[model samples]
Target: MTRRSCPCGLPETYEACCGRFHSGAAAAPTAERLMRSRYCAFVKGDAAYLLRTWHPRTRPATLEPDPGTRWTGLEILDTRDGSAFHSTGTVEFRASYRGGSLHERSRFERVDGAWVYVDGDFLS
Candidate 1:
């Protein structure tokens, strides 16, 4: 069987890279990992997983990914903190979608032993 590439752009298969997080078999150990997996979830249209990994404080009541949008690529620009020992961190990235694209600096924090997305600022 052919291995499906991870949406995170990792060399590993989706099942090995971000899929583990999506499947609840593992948790993202860093902010970048969380950000990548969240992007994978967006591509797969798994809003539940997105909400599940979101910081409760910032999590909205619901999430609805645009199914019409086709994700093209992910480019990580920078990172700060987000190590396993750190409780907080940030990741800046540009994600390409079909209709357009977005560049954002996203915040993350360790919540109950897992990295959870907090919020983000869109870049102009």
Candidate 2:
């Protein structure tokens, strides 16, 4: 049987996929979830949710999802245990657009019983 791929790159279903994270299911069991939600937030243009889920220390006071960027999809490549419930995770994916594509490896951390996005490294 062909394996269904997660738009977020994880080998999971859409229902069990990033939707779980966006639906507020534990803000992702690891850093990967945070990264997915952050991506979903961008796709949906949910700046408020993005800001709310971002780590306070690193979270910008204001977030402006790039208007010119049109995110096509997501693909999570690999991940590791950052820590415990509070862990670190990495996601490598490509976001396509009218102009070009953006490849990024985003980082996330779990803090205060919640997952928050810390930062990301542009791979492209």
Candidate 3:
């Protein structure tokens, strides 16, 4: 059997990288991991996982992945705080798609002992 690589651009298989988080078998240990998993969720169109990991205050009532968009890659540009000991953190990343790329600095916070996405500022 061939090992399928994770959509988050990690060398590991999806199951070992982000799939575990999506399945609720594990929670992301850090902000970067959460960001990576969230990107993976986007690629897979896993809206439920995305909402579950989103901060309640910021989570939308519904989510729908753009059917025409095709995500291609992820690059982590920087990170601050979002560790096991920190309650909040930020991740600066660039996610590329078929026609363009998205650059953002995303915020994360620990809620009920789990890391949840808060919001982000899109960068130019």
Top-scoring candidate (TM-score) = 3
Best by lDDT: 3
For candidate 1, what is the TM-score?
0.96
**1-124 in candidate 3: lDDT tens per residue?**
9897999988999999999999999999999999999999999999999999999999999999997889999999999999999999999999999989999999999999999999999999
- Over 61-107, each residue of candidate 1 has an lDDT whose tens digit, in order, gives 99999899899989999999999989999999999998788999999
Clashes of each: 0, 3, 0
TM-scores, all models, native as reference: 0.96, 0.72, 0.98
> For each candidate, what is the lDDT?
0.95, 0.70, 0.97
The ten-residue window of minimal lDDT in model 3 covers: 2-11
User: Stretches of candidate 1 above 4 Å error?
Assistant: none
| Residue 64 C-alpha lDDT in model 1 | 98
Per-residue lDDT tens digits for candidate 2, residues 73-104, read 66666666644544566666676666777787
Worst 10 residues of 2 by lDDT: 81-90
What C-alpha RMSD separates each model from the true structure?
0.9, 4.0, 0.7
Instruction: Please state the error at residue 29 of candidate 3 in Å.
Output: 0.3
Backbone clashes in model 2, listed as residue pairs: 8-76, 9-76, 82-88
Segments in model 2 whose C-alpha atoms lie over 4 Å from true places: 1-26, 82-86
